[model samples]
Target: MGSLCFNDGVQDDRQPWWKAATFYQVYPASFKDSNDDGWGDLPGLISKVDYLHGLGVDCIWVSPIFESPQKDMGYDVSDYQKIYAPYGTIEDVDALIQTCHERGMKLILDLVVNHTSAEHEWFQESRSSRTNPKRDWYIWKPPRYDAGGNRQPPTNWRGYFAGSTWTWDEHTQEYYLHLYASEQPDLNWENAETREAIYEETMRFWLRRGVDGFRIDTVNKYSKRTEYIDAAVTDKNSPYQAAPEMWCNGPRIHEFIREINQVLAPFSAVSVGELSNTPDPKQVLPYVSTRARELDMVFEFSVIRLGNGDLFTGKYIYKPFTLSQLKALTEKWQCFIEGTDSWATVFCENHDNGRAVSRFGDTSTPELWRASARTIALWQATLTGTLFLYQGQELGMTNMPASWDISHYQDVEAVNFFAEAVASRNEQRIQATKHGLSILARDHARLPFRWNEDDNVGFTTDSAKSWMRIPREKGISVESQLGDRTSVLEFYREMLRLRKRFQGVFVFGTHTLLDRENESTWAYIKEGFLTTKDGHRMRGRALVVMNFTVERAPLVDVSAALGCAPESTRLMVTTACGAVRGAKDELSAWEGRIYCDFGPEICI
Candidate 1:
């Protein structure tokens, strides 16, 4: 509701659109099939830009597009300079980047620098013989000679996909390490030559092509175990374990990030790392410091781990957080990042997780979709950072059909988690792990982007087969709702409009978290978007309340509460329950609403 201004200090001028960007992620293989092939590719993605642009997303983050073995669904990059044949080539990538830029949109690639495919030329060469020049490019150790003169693995550390993290290479007579699948061997980041080469190639490849930014995968693990540490000794005789700390954010981590940042700085390219530790502001600041290191922001994993109270308990987690936990986690991160050089990468879902609509709140009802979405966006954009939107999110995509059962799951994480559970012989944990795997797997988020409720959900061929199944109907689709003013697609458009309109608040605003919540309310405030030093000319202040319930909660009237300008106390907007004929109303079972007024103060 407050008056806004760009850095020019004139309330009359507007800020650049990117200051309030909304990013949407695309998992290419399962998104759309252009030539009627079984897998989705870049050309198919080109056809969908209109849909994304129509939804008002400013940036599109496509999952790993580099040439790969598909062991981790393109994450196991074999060639940073080349493109995956199935996804298309360098020209297709160039066209995709150009198309997005022409529409005033930005593109961020999923950077998987933590490891490389064993099939890559470097790995192939490294494994050929112990004396190979590239032998030190990856982690490797001699096999432990047994009493019988047979060879044994150097350690029992298990690979995430199935067995040991180390696979013996008979040709080289050494064991090569892989944190994920055996095909994705971990790179020896400690090696100056190896790390430098990767940084040089990866940076030079995209920056030269005019791409916007990167979403670093397993971002914290760039620096890894020189000791090749052993597993944590869990039950089921589990052998795979590397306290990522032993590797994550290691001694040379900052050095590598600084180097990458050097190459990216000239391009104004943004980088956001997927972080999974405690949100200690000091620890997180350098990576995003304008003056320091790697990324522009960090996407903390606490939100995704919300429902899982105790991961080590081996529990089956299939629930969502209450309005309380949601508000708290968001508030904590908001506070920390605002005070530090770091910015936050806001999110509820991404390529490796399930959709937020189904997970955060009930979307079975239409009203819920609008309310929850608006509530989510209000909180996200108002934070001191950028935001990410996984594909189909604008249309309010939910989790994949639960009816498919375990046999249908094809994601490596899902398959591996299932196997890991089975190997433990803990039936209860097995049940829990399987269900948890479904929610946590890439497959859940990889469902075809439903352009309409067409056969294959407008993704794969009717006669041809998709590597994965498409989502079932929920009345939520792009085609049916594209032109409808009362649809979720349009809701997103309005959200982006509002965010861009208040760019300063959504970008550099100082955040203050509301302390409490009932089942109905999630509240917070953004204060410094317009300040005296910035030549403040705002009509009033901004306080936002995202009510996740239908029952109206008690309010803290700004006129009577914080004692600011009364004129600004007038309601700026309602995410739902508005007055006009087409105005949206009461959220679905778990839908939400954002109410804004005066030099505002929210009633937590």
Candidate 2:
């Protein structure tokens, strides 16, 4: 195969190991439970290493496993070095890492350095006295007093969890900043000592434990320009809303990331920043740019933003996104990041969003469920980046049952949003509001893993309860899908194997969208040129076509588009439904196919 450098002249066909890897995100709490404690532990995760190995995952990204007060579900880290007791001890983490290595899989832990639990020893000392050495470790400012001596928050900024970004502390007579929950105080990255301590305690410590890397949470929020400025108000009713522009990708963000990168370079570790606040890929490029020496990649969220709605109403009250929109978004990122040292982290589902099938595809019936699952999975794997598959994704999991009420929700973000929406009744009508909240809740993804069809769906013993209610979806368990030849799990295995077989084309090839303007049909071409075993140059191409709707969509006539007859395209991977034959053939709802062909038959 011919080797080519990206347009930027820095990235070539030769990429890092992570660039060709497939990742599985395990939300530890809901992954699996051992010891009947109603919570998932490291031991539970260690036992599943084989399961992951069989799933063809190159890496497992375990969500935050640090010590905390359980507020914000472990994002609020009290101790950077200790594992949360419910999860297990440090030795368990070591064992898990070693086990993953033995299984030929890498482990990447969640790094929540943007904020620390208020109960952290440093925060405790900082609040104890104004003169404390650790006082500057957290963002602290004096309250703004009115003429009548009434105190207001230091800044008119709301946190991600709602309410003020600053919390008043009577002992220190000041307010500390928290971009997220008040219990999770933002760390002062401006302080050299604070940054150094984080390196030694979190990054270095974990690297020494033999962990591969980290998924840095809220990484773009690490640096904030020094100012007590009030953010522009789009909604007068919520004037103090958290200002992402002022804090996200702040002036020193790249510098700090480079510093962290330098420390990680020696260990040969990789990091993907959770650039949650960055809505534009342009804003994210620098952080992952090879020239910047920062993160290896960053999570771009344009696709997820499609399902979201008004800030107050959340993602539930939204219009359906079209295939054109998905195509445009993916191509936009692919075009921008193709040649640069920067890479993309592509995923359609995670612990924070509703299940992909429920949110992006029709799941009202069994056939639609599988088709929808396969379509999204095929599209994700064919993209030009690292692929992250959330647990149960391969099993074609749907969202929480529509009948579940507020009591069944477990994620703090969803639960708090429900209460806040109800309390702020004037914002919208009550009944319609509750319906939307239930559909958009994050708990839909946090439910326990469905292992089999049993009393607890095989998540736990009959006598043992789960930390959160486990919603039962018949035939969606691993046990049910394991041996089924046409099941979603098998489909995923085939997709992965095919990807591995055509790694050069899928991972390093040039990506081109063929039907950017078509709403019902999304098609793309991935092609690469490589040297054959006998030293002859060969070109391989994979044409991916999908029907994003339930109704049959007319097959796109690629004869004119690609200058190749439809009969010449060989079916590679597809849904259980057979491939289309003629130029005007139609596809079943959610049906898709990847056709393998040789040469420059398809235009790049």
Candidate 3:
């Protein structure tokens, strides 16, 4: 290995696969359909290896595909080691993994270990009798009795999907804990036998089968407080309560992760934990710290919180995510992780949230919509971490159709909120709530990946009824944008290609937030060195300046730091093509650019 210019011009060189890779997330059920079943299966995904390769991503992070009761759409795992029947057989999954490797793309599966489907064999046996050998595999406590001898739930904790966290088990005469749906029972990580069994049967099982890595689902909620305490009631009538302090990043979370990491280390497996709602950067560092032996990185929700209108309520409210807010959150993470062994996952949208273009972009006009997509791409691609692009993101997908009825929404979160709102019988509130949800629903991203402008948006045969409605009228199909010079898809392709061309500057350069107090504009500088194969070296500075708002903003000068006149800097990439100007040129609405003192050729 040669020297990494960002670390030094001569000696330090450590190239972890994840550190240099760009990740693409695919919601398996919405990617493709080979047999016209209206549902995407492993074979359907296997058939799209070329398309993924063409997109220039280094790896694909697939959502859960385990055998499930479909209670939570595959999150409720009945058998951790088996593939869902509708998705395909174990052989089909092996084939998909093999195909991705053959195409030079690594595959990362979703690891849902926090809970298992109530229909799981282990759960069934545990619920049968108190003397069952597997009785301790899940949480179970005797019901609390009131003065009148009336039975009550063990605790007043609320389920994430609504209702009480504890469900009465008549047969066993006890109450079981479920943080999610009642069909999903929380696994007892406290049991040494349970943890070891999961490691052997699930973790090592997939690693032995050539899995590249895993995206641990709900990882922050894995370890609950040993004492089952009632969460303080904030709203008595609301089905859910605020209890993150008791469960998130709990006592043994770091210990559990370190043990899991020990198992993954031998296989060279990478992992990223879904740890949302952890506000303190200090609190989040341990999960991804090299010294901690936990995860490669963890997904933080600071940016997501800004886009999510209702932080406390179910993202059922609409609040505009402003330019200033985006800057403060991103800069904090970037600065915090710099020079540390820990890392951050830079992404704007995924299966759990609406499209970034819909949440942050000006979708009211076609040019602004496209430009917003480009602006987001520029921001993510040049960030100091692994980049993740959800399916259809490259094509600049918009929110689901405004005309879509609540009936068309398929996400459990949206459905539950709608049902609860309707029960209130307030027409004004119902209309207002639904209106906000129209822009924030998770289904907006869960819709089928648009491959072409066919009758079914090229996801399936025209006659096949899709599992979820496709917004065909959006006209944002991959095929239509594949070769269009100015299309969002092409813009992404260019950004990715440039990242590969200048990996050191983008991946290892020291990050510095510029114009920290600016409200209308957000800017950052990445300074590092570029080395060539012939051993020639050039000091490089990459400047990312953006007008995040909808109004033109005057540019500022950074020529002294750039070591050259700002006007002389090379424009490596930009949402709008024009002369390189660092002093007087005003950025157009929603416009951004990547400026480098030295050209990308210096890295080569």
Q: Which candidate's TM-score is highest? A: 3
Query: Per-model C-alpha lDDT, please?
Result: 0.69, 0.79, 0.81
Model 1 poorest 10 in a row by lDDT:
580-589
Candidate 3 residue lDDT tens string, 249-351? 8889888988899999999999999996688988988888888889997888788657455444445756666677888888887778866778777888888
Model 1 lDDT tens row, 465-543:
7767665685677778776766667767776776666555555566666646666766566654343334445432456
Candidate 2 backbone collisions, by pair? 1-530, 1-531, 2-529, 2-530
Minimum summed lDDT over a 10-residue window in model 3 is located at 3-12
- Deviation in angstroms for 579 in model 1? 9.1
Clashing residue pairs in candidate 3 are none
Provide TM-scores for the models: 0.88, 0.94, 0.95
Clashes of 2: 4
Tens digits of per-residue lDDT, candidate 2, 58-80, equal: 99999989999989889999999
Candidate with more favorable, higher lDDT: 1 or 3: 3
Runs in model 2 with CA error above 4 Å? 1-13, 311-316, 427-429, 531-535, 565-567, 578-584, 599-604
Q: Candidate 2: lDDT of 392? A: 88
Q: TM-score of model 2 relative to the true fold?
A: 0.94
